[model samples]
Target: MTVTPPPSRSAGRVATAVERASSALGRLRRGRLLHPAGRSFVGETVIWGTPGPPSGVALLDQPGRYRTTVRLSKGTPTPGSWPDVLGLALRLHHDDGRPFDLLVSSSGAAPGLRNLPLPRRRFTGTYSTITCYRAGRRRLWLAVLADPDSVDLGRSLATAVAATRTDTPRLVLAVASAVGPWRLVGQVSLGAQLSAEEDAALAFDPVRNLPPELRVAGPLAWLRDQTYRGSRRARGATAQSGGSTATTV
Candidate 1:
């Protein structure tokens, strides 16, 4: 698949500058810049093959397990609270030394549900991105379906990584698209969780570590760099100010 190049270098620089300015303002008001104030955790999950026939997308072609780390946060930095937008950032490591990074925000799961006001949710709720991947000529989205009664379990998965200590709870990664209905594509099982400090230092950039097959498109893709770049600027400012440290959001 042919992926379009990112925004021009000049546009990127301008976006980065705007992001730095926003970080500066955040720093001035809060005394320290917290790019994203949300719960973070690490786990292990398998990206199972799509049900039925092959999708023709090389990355979505088979059963694959990955060591995963997820940073869950709100769109607005609400302290210990959820809001209109839910940000779920994923980094997957494979056995062949390749890494897959995906950053998606929860808006609406279905095509008809697009742009509708999202209800408030906690750390335990399911998060999804609408139509993110390209499967040959088709577009699709991935969702992490969480159990209704699994709120505490979800939080626990983030705090510690011990595979739930009993039954290894499975989370489904469903792929959906405008052309077709949702399809079960992959599964994730948490093995270990990252420490709070490690989580704080983790950087989740879909662009930097993403696989070649999964490229973000549309206007949202252009704005993604501004976010990472701004968070980076904020981290630098915080370090220079001798305040608390952060890596990315």
Candidate 2:
């Protein structure tokens, strides 16, 4: 039919875009969200496994469709008080709009203090462009930047995503700007993964089981804060900056 030509081409374009997205997602869903090699620098590594994870843990609220790990220096993340022990590697796998599984690794980096509104760099922002899947029971975080300090959080989260991509192979971190909020969703555990006589050059004695200037806290507190508070409270859901709200949950 005369009208069929344009529609066919339009469908082709849509199909191509879908194929690209699918291919990328498939790779994300399959590979190691956090490579073991990248995590050699963390002080204490907590691995949240598939099919029954650690107790008091919400990640099991949903199934870990894909397995991965993230190493982070755990502590209370406030503005100006603490430092990012190491740059983190955060990789998430999406399965049907939920972040089915996630892997994140951390390494310490003194990004230096900034005078931003919230000292967000002192805190880490874990954000993603497209979150296709989430673990059931696990919380979702959406960060909306409205005040002076919040935008710094957005930038920090973006940096975390970028660092994660560089730590692994064939990994891509998607960053996009939407109208309402920027979201960070997942059930990835926090803390660092240790190795035998590790090689990354953080000169801490392993036997002490203590990392210098490093403290531990519950896993994924930031994510939990967003998942429970942000999504439910319209304020959290609609927290924004620059005439828009950016969310991470």
Q: State which candidate has the highest lDDT.
A: 1
The CA lDDT at 13 in model 2 is: 61
The lDDT of each candidate is 0.54, 0.26
Q: Which stretches of candidate 1 lie over 4 Å from their true place?
A: 1-13, 22-35, 79-84, 95-98, 114-117, 147-169, 236-249
- Reference-based lDDT, residue 182, model 1: 62
Predicted candidate 1 versus true structure: per-residue lDDT over 148-222, tens digit per residue:
433244332233233354444456666666546667777655433445566556665555455555666665555
Once superposed on the true structure, which residue ranges of model 2 sit more than 4 Å away at CA? 1-64, 73-86, 91-121, 124-177, 183-185, 196-249
TM-score of every model versus the real structure: 0.72, 0.23
> Model 2 compared with the native: what TM-score?
0.23
Alpha-carbon error at 97 in model 1, in Å?
Answer: 4.1
lDDT, candidate 2, at 119: 20
What does each candidate score in C-alpha RMSD?
6.2, 19.4
Best by TM-score: 1
